[model samples]
Target: MAEHPAYPVGLRLTGRRVVVLGGGQVAQRRLPALIAAGADIILVSPEVTPSVQAMADAGEITWHQRPYEEGDLADAWYALIATGDTEANTRASAEAERNRVWCVRSDDADEATAWTPATGHSEGVTVAVLTTDARGRDPRHTAAIRDAVVEGLRDGTLVAPHHRTRTPGVALVGGGPGDPDLITVRGRRLLAEADVVIADRLGPRDLLAELPPHVEVIDAAKIPYGRFMAQEAINNALIEHAKQGKSVVRLKGGDPYVFGRGMEELQALAEVGIPCTVVPGISSSISVPSAAGIPVTHRGVAHEFTVVSGHVAPDDERSLVDWPALARLTGTLVILMGVDKIGKIAEALVAHGKPADTPVALVQEGTTAAQRRVDATLATVAETVRTEDVKPPAVIVIGEVVKVGPTATAPRE
Candidate 1:
């Protein structure tokens, strides 16, 4: 395949309608980057996987659950044929041409619109190394090695562009609510000096811009509500990035410790040759609530606070958080990802002991300008959420915390 001389052009997938044609782990691996690139993606497959389902549910992607049909390609701007079934992908490719939609054949060697290049970026500068791959080598393996090699070359060419890596202390920086500038001054300073930045997707574009252009940004695999790439992979990525004689910043949104899986990664690093340290952050767990003017800890209405994940599996074989305990527990109860199970959670709390009228507020896309909140009670928060169009990336606050301010002050539940 001849490389388009303009191939390296920075491609912004923003607002384009993209169709992904697979639903398995491979499809999962391909989804986030496209979503991260801001493409409006729709997955077309008979059997959709959980990650894809969640993205669809969160309204991040449009999920077509039925089997692929001929006309599915009609209005797409670009299409990605990722169905493991090569025949389906091939057929989709053909359909793409018929509809005049630009498409990438996930399986074929020479038939498609754009080949996904090995990608890496710093600040707003994006770099992609296109593989001529004429020998028909495995593109995935080749891309991985190419990315690593590029990093080695980048290390030597960089100076002040990467001073962030040479910083003396770890900055437990909050990447910010959304806009990169919302990040604390301390966070920016640390990011500026971070020799090694281990970032999740939560880190914003501007925060990343603080890094040297050559800095190696490891792309970690995200498995929603499920296990992430083994902690070993993340630990090794950070340790290796640092051992290459660079400083490291283990970055997470809100706070590293707040359900951010910071402890697990830190332990892995500590077990290996690397030592561990922490920089505390402004936890969105509470800050997002405050932004909505609904305090998690109020003066008279609320005091104690308990944070729990809506998705985390019980650690003990015999867990103790039955509805009775939850209902009776004092202070505030903050639940993450409890949206799907909001009904069950509320039901349990009420049935066990809590009042059905207990106030509950569900906040999503928290702190960003797009934030939405649904306020209700132990009995109706879920129903309220269903009717209100609340989405994921949300946090839930139950108990008297809902009454922190004048009822009129915060966005209504």
Candidate 2:
């Protein structure tokens, strides 16, 4: 036998018979890729791992529930010999060779007619890598290479200009909390593909620095009570850039729909017949509390949790929140954009029958390096904010659930 370089080729096994001679870990791993390829999979084994049996139960594959036979490869376009039984695997491999079918042996790669390459997919591109040498094979090294290539492609570090197919549209991507790594994969990929990114000050700011130099980065910072970009103007920017045949990504902090005015932008885009993609993000309402070791709902403590915007005072005519109704409920209340009105909000809750001694936590800049938690009673929360010098972009958690987590023992301000 001569050692030679292996020729790599993709198999179009859709609707073709693929016989798997085992039901153990190896079969468990290979069955998914086979099923994903639309292959008609047949598993011949008396016993199978729970995961492999699940595939049979789901009708994803046919289970023979018996040992492999000589004629098992009669109609198989491909065979995977991974029963882990020396005699059985050898017998199956010989049968596959006799039938002139491509076979992969889990126990002996040298005897296998085909090898599975380390594979990955990114942006509609499939990468397959195989390292073959006289010194033998290194599957782990091959997989590492595959991962590096896929990650580089995803983060816009390694440019494959010829593979790009630009599509002009508006993507309302939720940047997720305040961490760059927390953004959704689709959102990050769209950001990499963006020609113009209209970013909010709240989202993963670090990600913007990674964008290609050719990309246009616009500051749409909506600072509270400060210089901000108007909502209408932001919408116009999206419409104008998209109309000019450019991909526009409106990156927002937290979830776009959660008090982020994402719907306003979407509706504005819709009016002009511009296509829009809404990628939901992790809202600060819940994530911020969690980051500070506070569970919004704890067993036997809070059965329901409500998220409210505190941007408007309860006494304001523009306010829509039912502060009285909220006070009546026994569940946890998570407040966003309420730092400025914490005193008024605390007063309203107490006046509406909510206990003045109800536990309160303000997690500032949650999930970021500057994150800090301040504790106080509902009655003292206003003074606590003033004394602690808490600022905007903090999540105010109210109710007994705040006292149920690790932050329960935190010193009150």
Which one is best on TM-score? 2
For 1-413, candidate 2 gives per-residue lDDT tens digits of 32687888999999999999989999999899899999999999999999999999999999999988889998999999998689988988998899899999999888889888888888688999988672567888889999999887776677666555666899999999998888887789889888999999898999999998999999885422323558878888889999999999999999999999999999999999999999999999889899999999988999999999999999999999999999999999999999999899989999999999999999998999999999999878888898999998899999998888866655364
lDDT of 1 by residue, 1-413 (tens): 54433254555689987888877776787788989989988888888788878878899888888777787887788888878777777888889888888777767747886767767654344556666554554668757866665443433223234434343323334565455555654456556556667676665554675567765555455422235556667666766765666667767777778777788777776676566566556676777677777778777777688877776323333444554666788789988756777777777777778888888887777767678767888777777888887777788888877876554223334
Global CA lDDT computed for model 2:
0.90
* Model 1 alpha-carbon drift over 4 Å, by segment: 1-182, 222-229, 313-323, 406-413
- Measured with C-alpha atoms, the lDDT of residue 329 in candidate 1 is 83
The CA lDDT at 273 in model 2 is 94
Instruction: Give the per-residue Cα lDDT of candidate 1 at 294.
Output: 79
Q: How accurate is candidate 1 locally (lDDT)?
A: 0.69
RMSD of candidate 2 to the truth, in angstroms, is 2.5
CA lDDT, candidate 2, residue 124: 80
Could you tell me every candidate's TM-score relative to the true structure?
Answer: 0.53, 0.93
Name the candidate that leads on lDDT: 2
Report lDDT per candidate: 0.69, 0.90
